[model samples]
Target: MRADRLMTIMILLQNRGKMTAKELAEELEVSDRTILRDMDALSTAGIPVVSDRGKDGGWRLVDNFRSQLSGLTMDDLKSLFLFPSGKVLEDLGLHSGALDTRQKLLAAIPGTFRGEAEAIWERIHIDSSTWRASKENLDALKTVQQAVWESKKLTILYEQADGEQNERVVEPLGLVAKGDTWYLVAIRDSEFRNYRVSRIHKAIVENETFIRPANFILAGYWEQSKEEFIQRLPAYDVQVEIHPSVMKRLYFTSKFVQVIKKESSSPDQWIEATLRFNAEQEAVEYIVGFANKMKIIAPKDLKSKVVSLANSVIDFYNEL
Candidate 1:
């Protein structure tokens, strides 16, 4: 552990040129005495660590000192160019630094791999936002980001689906940006829950702090939650007879429906297919779009609803 601290101190001195013992201690979450000992260790190990004593004095690496990461290969250098989505970076207030960080990384690569590594940027770009997604109001984003970084608790006013407002004090863990939307994953009452960033009417960083769970990984936990949520959803199957021409339009018509099985009765004229929906009303609404091009084959109740809805539409159109 001390070896790691010594190496980290050396790297910091090399990059920062100069830093006070107190500053290093704060950055490493240690005491000033430990930092002084680490400095002595680095100097004893043949590193040129210069320490000054005065009003404007601190530790610094001797002039002409250069320490580069020798283990980096061409692929490693290229991977450094990979960055998160721009919207996410902007929310975290790192958009400006992202570009500067990439360029500085390019300058750090050895000449042998520099050209090939820089070519990655010229060839690749990542766009995570969906086309024409409405921009979310992220006024609370910066406050929530700071809380996550500082491991501070947050008292937030959240809007619920029933139009009721609830205030919760959550331990801010991580943020996930999908398309133009942001989801705040946090711990409340010792349970992990997700809150939409846009739905947060107010966010106040509390003075309290929370010990982050040692094994709670943001990416892994979010994925597991998604899988569990999907598994818990009730799925119903619908049997339908669809004309061959109408099947192509089914894909774009419903987001919740998908064909599970198909049987060809007349060898390409009509297809009997089983589709999945979350509810019976969903099935009825989707079936109504096809009109006479499709017919319900089973679930007599759903068929009756479709007929009733169709007749209602006919009556409404007749009055016009």
Candidate 2:
């Protein structure tokens, strides 16, 4: 571990030029004293580490010395070649560039590890889109991307989930791709918000540039926002008995349903399970789709609704 830390220190100093002991310690999750000790060790090993004092002082390598300590492990090589979805790259106009980069990386790595890296690309593949392949309209993505890159304000016509259109002027901060969908993280009316790129019907980049917030980190903000959004979702729980034959089907339909618990049963016997949905209507609709394969055990009102809906479907078909 100490050897790894020493190598990391050398790489950090080589790349960042100068970093204070406190900064290095915070980054490496160590103590300031530990960082100072590491610096002394590096100097003793004739690494040419020089430390200066005062407010603008830190540790740096002397005479523009570059270390040849950079190396990639097998896992690192695999991670570099684990490409994201091709459609996502095309959406960002990076598909061709990504292909070129992949070729260059294959040629640049050490020849000893080349065969394993090539095998990784051939054996493993990632498909991030849903099975249904819901198409998204991202015509405004290029404009939004440009605004984010230039730190420019934008005038946008955004359509809400309820089909209401509203025009707003926002300061573009960053773009995030969750699954196959893209969202623009921006500041509107001095508050941070995420706008679905598909819902952006129109976008006009403005000439005025806004100063980005110093404390805002794109990835950090997205993670916090995602967690908060999940916490705010409504939940409706239900108990049911599902036929053993359809057990695998239940697990496959997880986009709208979550299995909370399952009671043990014989292979041919019905399995008692608890499931959760976003609302009572959704639960009823989902349960009824399984036909006679599932039976609701609790919430008498939900069972009645499901029965009524199923009968209505039958009566309509009979009339037809």
Candidate 3:
């Protein structure tokens, strides 16, 4: 295990130059003393590990020193070939480049590791898109990506969820792909905002470039923003008794509904479950669809709405 940790330290220093002992310890999830000992071991092992003392000083490998990829273990080699979905690569226009990179890596690594890497590639695949054939309009994705890559400003015509269109100039920070959907994270009027790529009607990459914030990490920001968005959503809880047959279906429809908690089985074999929706209307719409398969246990208003909606549907059909 120490050998793996030592090799990881070397790789880290080789990739990201000048990491402080505290930083390295934090990254490797070890104590500072352990990192210092690892450094000593690397040095004694003929590794050119050096430490500088100053405000911005840290441990670094000597100039021109690079670790060999041949030192990677079988697991590491397998990890290198763990690619995302082909659709994701195509979205980023890296499908061909990804194929080329795989070939180059296979050619570059030692012959001993090549077979395992190639085998892993054939055995493993990832598809992050949903089952439904929903396509997003990404007409502005290329221009937005270009601005993000160039660290340039972007002027976009964005359509809001309410269908209101607005034009604004923003500092293109990064683009994030959540499943098949893409979002542009940018700074507009000194505030961080997320613009759905599908809603971006037009994008113009500005000639002027802006300095990227030193502390802005795209992944971290997106995660925090996602959490905040979920927290801000309106929660409407509904208690229901679902038939045995529809229990799995309730879990499957997770996008618009969340199963907050489940109670013990009812005497008649029905399942008591607590479900959450964004609004009362959403609960009414969903519960009404289940018809007799699901029955509302509490919240008299929701029961009334469902009955009223069901009768309305019945009456409308009867008229035909």
TM-score to native of every candidate shown: 0.71, 0.73, 0.74
Candidate 3 residues 1-320, lDDT tens each?
89978877776675566899999999888999999999999999999999999999999988736634757888788778887777778888875721245665664566567678889988988898878854789889999999999999999999989999999999989999898998999999889999999999999998999999888899999999999999999999999989887877887665799988888775569888899999999999999888799989878777888989999999999999
How would you order the candidates by TM-score, starting with the best? 3, 2, 1
Q: Give the poorly placed runs of model 2, Cα more than 4 Å off.
A: 1-71, 97-99, 110-112
The digit string of per-residue lDDT tens for model 2 on 62-136 reads: 965664325879999889899888877888887562124555566456656768888998899888776777589
Candidate 2 whole-model C-alpha lDDT, 0 to 1: 0.87
Question: Lowest-scoring 10 consecutive residues by lDDT in candidate 2?
Answer: 95-104
The pairs that clash in candidate 2 are none
Q: Give the TM-score of candidate 2.
A: 0.73
Which pairs of residues have clashing backbones in candidate 3? none
Residue pair clashes in candidate 1: none
lDDT of 1 by residue, 86-141 (tens): 76677677757212566556545554665777688788778887767666778998
Q: lDDT-based ranking, best first?
A: 2, 3, 1
